[model samples]
Target: MTFSLVGHCAETGQLGIAICSSSIAVGARCPWLQPGVGAVSTQNITLPALGPQVLEHMACGLSPTQALDSALTRNGYSQFRQLAAIDYRGRTAHFSGSETLGCHHTLPGELCVGAGNLLAGASVIEALVRTFETSGGQLADRLLAGMQAAVAAGGEAGPVHSAALVVVGELTWPIIDLRVDWADEDPVGKLAQLWAAYRPQMQDYIVRALDPTQAPSYGVPGDE
Candidate 1:
């Protein structure tokens, strides 16, 4: 019921994940990332705890494959989960459990891993990897492009009701975290709109958090 991609921007040291699913609030459950660690997506039977556990392993200096392998070994229901991870160095790994629903696939790219369960076909994962590889822009833009390509390639087995994009840079908090938890129409498109509106002010908000006197005003009520 979900399709997701986890990636790293070697040029900027950024880690991010983008996901969409037929289920509601996929964002809250499927994606996880730490600024200097790694990114993970846990879908299918969706053991949400596995996401942070994988990140913790990567943070402890384990390679993405090693972290994923260790995490799966501890899970008795590993066969029912679909997982993907990318370490801080852009090393990637992915697993699609034998019990995953519908036509599922996983593709590991140069600095990313794409995974899906209950998907349209292998082409969806392929499109995600191709878009992320060829698309030129910020890490957030590339991640969004990958999600767009996934939808263009037919997306999940059913209409995706929720979508999310999360990117982490130097900040402890996510630099970009946007979601359409549930939408009758296209949640990915809705999330894209939110990104467009937030991108320009992203640094400004960070500045406000770090030093309000140096922060730029966007003519908001308190600016005067």
Candidate 2:
């Protein structure tokens, strides 16, 4: 069973996504990104390798639909694929293959989409989308809210095992990539909590990565 969130942060100019599954370690295999190009979520019958290629297609100037089409077309088992893409400009597109694991569905909005397969109920994707729009915050907040939205709507057919979120810039490895490789239950909530606790540190890490030679001359006490 699978549940995933793909969205872009207009404020930060970052594109990101979070995914969780009944199967273990979906994050490691499902989410991928290119700093200034875009982000991709390759789920359902997951193909971890295709994740970056989707971004590559887009970076080559493919539209969301074209990029998705090309990526799926290349796969022999395209019928079972599920994908979400957000381009550098934040134009979004999503598709749930007709042959997705089981009873799969998708909900797409202006700049985001929620997709699932083998879920407990049909309304799950819609609930994810609705909550995402209602959350009203930064892109990461909305993305987390959307993941919570899916969980509140019943999530996977079984307990969740893994979750991940990745926000990237054009050259950044991952701006805010959080992975809960496995959790006992309520993986999404756990993920959000982790994000809150690590957000400041994550910010510092990115700043340091961008300009490692420059040290913080002063701040709060020993932090300097």
Candidate 3:
């Protein structure tokens, strides 16, 4: 009951994933990213540890295909999982095991890969990759657009309750990580709204973390 896309932005050297699921808190479990390494999404039965494991493999110089193969090989339940990864070089890979849920598919594109299980149809994944590859602007914007397009085309087999968008740049920490853990309706839309609100302050937050004295004021109470 999950659909996800992992992408790399060549212009800015950013990597990220956008995901939606019928389950609660999909963000807390699925997406994994290392600033200069890559992005990975582990869903469909969701072995959360596999996200990190795959990233570790990528960090050690494996291609997305090899990293996924190495990681899944070590797992006892590989056949129950669905995964996608994109490396810093924009190379992509994906896998949908034999036991994936209804209407699963994977679409690999220039700088992104979309994969899902228990989806409405293969069109959902196609929409994800197509929109991501064609859209313009920041990595976060393309990711959000891809997700919205997928929902517009046809989402999961049922209503999705959780959505997450994560983007990592040069820092060890993510530049953008937004989630709507559980929403009765339109979780992806809610996630997009969060990204909109966070966008203007995203770089400021990074500066604050690195050097607070040079950072802008909070504009609240005592800071004024």
For this target, which candidate reaches the highest lDDT against the unseen true structure? 3
Per-residue lDDT over 53-130 for candidate 1, one digit per residue giving the tens place of the 0 to 100 score:
999899998998899899999877888989999988888989887899999999999799999988888899999999
Q: lDDT tens digits, residues 96-146, model 3?
A: 999999999999998999999988889999999999999998999999999
Q: How much lDDT does each candidate structure score?
A: 0.91, 0.80, 0.94
How many backbone clashes does every candidate have?
0, 3, 0
RMSD of each: 1.1, 2.6, 0.8
Q: For candidate 2, what's the RMSD?
A: 2.6
Please list the residue runs of candidate 3 whose C-alpha ends up more than 4 Å from where it truly belongs after superposition.
Answer: none
Q: What is the Cα-based TM-score of model 2?
A: 0.90
Please give, for residues 1-224, the per-residue lDDT of candidate 2 as tens digits.
Answer: 88787887666777888888887778789888887788788888887767777888899999877988888888767877888878878788788877888767787775777788988887888888788777887778888888887787778887888888787755557777788888888778888888999876766776676796674443667773
- Residue 33 lDDT (model 2): 80
TM-score of 1: 0.97
